[model samples]
Target: MRIYLYLIAGITSALIGWNIGQFFLTDLGLFSSFPELILYPCIAISLAIGMVLNEIFISSPTRPKLCLKKAKFPVLIALGLGLIIGLFSGAIAQILFLPFFGIPAVIVRIVGWLLIGVAVGLAEGLTWRWETVEAGDKKRFLHRLIASIGGAMGASFLAAILFEVVRVFLQEMPKNLRLAEDPIGFSVLGLFLGLTFSLTSSPSYLVALRAGSGFEYVSQIFAQISPESINLSKDYPRIDQSVLTFVSDSSLDRIEEGLSIKLPSKGSFKIGSNNDCHIYIPSLPDHVATIEIKSREAILIPHVLYFNHIAINGEDLKTKKNIVLKHNYLVTFYSILKGENNSENTIIINHEKIFRFVYYNRFFDPQG
Candidate 1:
């Protein structure tokens, strides 16, 4: 289903660009070489934009919090590459001039479009590479770059071949009096281009949550509070049990545990007392905090209501809107009602519900 969507988007973009170029060609027919000058550029620009949009659409579900500001450079790269490849293709085709070099025009056009696909892939790969480079790991840079670029080129090559096959069939069809068959080949090329790219691109990241060093404190408190424990339901049976024990002096006998969950790599997730939140903490207020896990770092944004009670590494987040979470950072969400003084310097009365997790930069694999 998703492959179909990509194909449809790709094909539609190509045909639309081609038709728009044709419209311009007909409207401004003063020069004989206008079609040659205008048509390929239009197609290249459209394909470039289409490929980028397709990549975004495919990646948006997993990377919902991707910042456009950060993507400006890569988008420009893809557009530039696409235009250059298109012009190069046109020039090569004209210079070679169909069988002058003993190679077919179709082959030259295929190679040209192939390079365009490579451009799109290279842009996407660079975008992924750029995000990970900020994490200070240069070891995997070359490997990742090769993987992304290689996958895109491979997919584009396959798409080009498939498009050529389809074009052959289209060419044999009866002369079209109404609709031109030229756009059909472009549509086919676009369709396969998107589908193949999707297949070849890296898999989306899966967030990993394990018992961090801070969990030792919580674990010790849990052991001291209750000697005997009853079993609880596990939300995701595949992963390790993520248990959050709510221990109080008065409620030692009734130590309740909430279902712990691993956050998805999708950038933004709401965590609160609300049942609908990604992570539910009973002591925290409804919609207490938002966690945005990007390619480089994880950020925690506490709701204004629980500003005084929440603290990261003993420092209260009173005036701050969000904090970038580092490895072993203890994000303590204190119970507001049970606190003695809710001031920034003073600690809350019951601070046991601490979210202690390690942020692993390696968890986000651009190659995969």
Candidate 2:
């Protein structure tokens, strides 16, 4: 299978979905008349792209050849995946946008359901579902997960580049806090964005890969690679059973020293405590975690590129660690995983609000 061809197909699918979605938005007068209204269609289209591309990969053996006969399956798969992607993404989007926009929640729910078709379609196109893998695959889940991480990192970097280019062209920066004008609303928005991204991108693919055939390899590797990412989230901490120990800034004074049991709120969760965000964020599994964060002031800092993980070029984890303490650094739990590249279980921290972190050229200070 030609990787580049797959990429091309993915891009083409996105464009097609976007155009179709754009029409829907235009007709509803959503962009201007009710900006929130368009979110579902726009995102559904994006998912449609993913679903279609994934479908193409599926059913095509030995380097996908140009055959229209086989193309229909992906479209069908896309329709199915799009239904899911659209509803879930749209629901998340609505939760986030409604409070800020003051639109009714029911409306957003309806919107989400409406776009499920597109979402299902996009998932088919974009996801790395194994059914789509070409013949003669050699790599196990571990390798595929690694490849996914690499791909996701690349895609994220490209997105950063594109966003920057667009920002420069428009003479403006992305919005961070106005969305915060309604914290509850913004939180919902973040959830939607996270769901959208998870469904439509590398996170989904990576999770699938890790969960598939090589689940053992994926699980073992994560177990061997931690202690650094222990408490990235207040509510959700990274868990690797193979490794008993955990890292945290806050002492585990509140819980019984040896007591480990089920969590009441979410069925079950391991208890560990920490104040430091750096170790937690990077330490957590790379494939499936949620990051609850927002930009501080929305300023584009120079020399700061957010890749698979955020890093200052030439600086080591040590420096990034220091940067975390001095400035809260908008920390949150993120599930980083090896990418067999087709799991849709990622949780994203979106539109994070970090008001205290200040930047000084190549350096950062937690104090705003």
Candidate 3:
């Protein structure tokens, strides 16, 4: 269901961007005098910008602080790969339509877009770190290559059919408009290619944080947290106000419908008192805990001075080792001397602040 939403959002944004670009280039005649050198870069950059925009608005919202930093690399990769792929695709199309080969122009055009789609997919795929075992690097490359080729080729064929339909429709119109060329086909091609890349590259598990007990007015879910230090303190400086703002819910409503903050797909996040931690809880000491998440599982490693201060699901983390996180696993960080569990199973920290968390795992099967 979420994947469907992602595809819808990605394709819609691509079509909008493509149409705006088309209006400028075709209708307004902007950059009409530019040579191939300038035009190719413009097209390539446009596609890159679209891709980055989709990721920033959609993917980065899951962890908003890292959005700016995430944009730089994917844009560069897409720009370089788009240019190289365009040249390669153009050369292939030219050869296919040559007198010797005698292939139809339409056939060659489809093939060209097919190749471009594959390259686009590969370019997006390369931006993420794929976790695998046994010949990981080679396997990852081949996986991206094959997935992109298949997905992109399918999209290109679909676009070709749609292009012909629109062409026929325009030819029959009262205005006698003719389909001179495909101005919008590439955009459709880009839309599906982006969707393909997202489907293949999305993480297996999504981790989110709900404001548990310590928070007063914060009942919303935080969808993204900074990878380095996630300060839970309401007064923490440097925190993005947008990230923390959400409609407050009643206590019962919060338990049923509260929003949560999503951590990055892979990172070591610190939860501490000061700004140095990845997550800061105002009442907790410096560096109280660290959450190391990778692939499908998250582990809670305590760093507090007292073992009794923190517990998972009412079990004290006495082994002093990493504890695997589970869904609805309550992790309470409180002062042993002053805190006590209430009727609702929530801990009241130091009689004033209560730092309690209920973990929820998304998309992955429950682990014992």
Q: Tell me, what's the RMSD of every candidate?
A: 14.9, 21.8, 13.7
Candidate 1: C-alpha RMSD after superposition: 14.9
Model 3, span 1-368: residue lDDT tens: 54555565545544554565566666888754432223333444455455544544454345545555656777677777767876577567666767998887777767666665655565555554321121134654567557655775676677666766676676776553453334455556555656665666544336755556655443224414443334343453121232222112212222212344446668777776676665555556656788888886889888746445677876666766778898678887764223343544453335234466767665221110
Question: Sorted on lDDT, highest at the top, how do the candidates line up?
Answer: 1, 3, 2
Error of 3 at 294 (Å): 21
By TM-score, the best candidate is 1
Mark the regions of model 2 whose C-alpha exceeds 4 Å error after superposition: 1-7, 28-73, 98-165, 172-368
Residue 60 Cα positional deviation in candidate 1, in Å, after optimal superposition: 5.0
Number of the top candidate by lDDT? 1
At residue 155, give the lDDT of candidate 3.
68
Which digits, one per residue and each the tens of the lDDT, describe model 2 over residues 1-368? 33344454444444454555557666655555443345444444454545344434433333455424445655555565554555465557556565678876544444443344334423442333333222112343344434433443344334333433443444443466333222222222223333333333331111000011101112335645873643223343223333221111122321121222111111111211233322122323333212211222112121122222332232322221223222212222223333455466753322221111111211110010
Off by over 4 Å in 1: 1-5, 30-37, 56-66, 130-141, 177-179, 210-368
> Of 1 and 3, which scores higher on TM-score?
1
Worst 10 residues of 2 by lDDT: 206-215
Clash numbers, per candidate: 1, 57, 16
How are the candidates ranked when ordered by TM-score, highest leading?
1, 3, 2
Cα lDDT computed for each candidate against the true fold: 0.56, 0.34, 0.55
Mind giving the per-residue lDDT tens digits that candidate 1 earns over 158-274? 767776776677667777822465686667667766676556543332343333422232354575577465223332112212322211111121222321233555567766667
- Give TM per candidate: 0.51, 0.31, 0.49
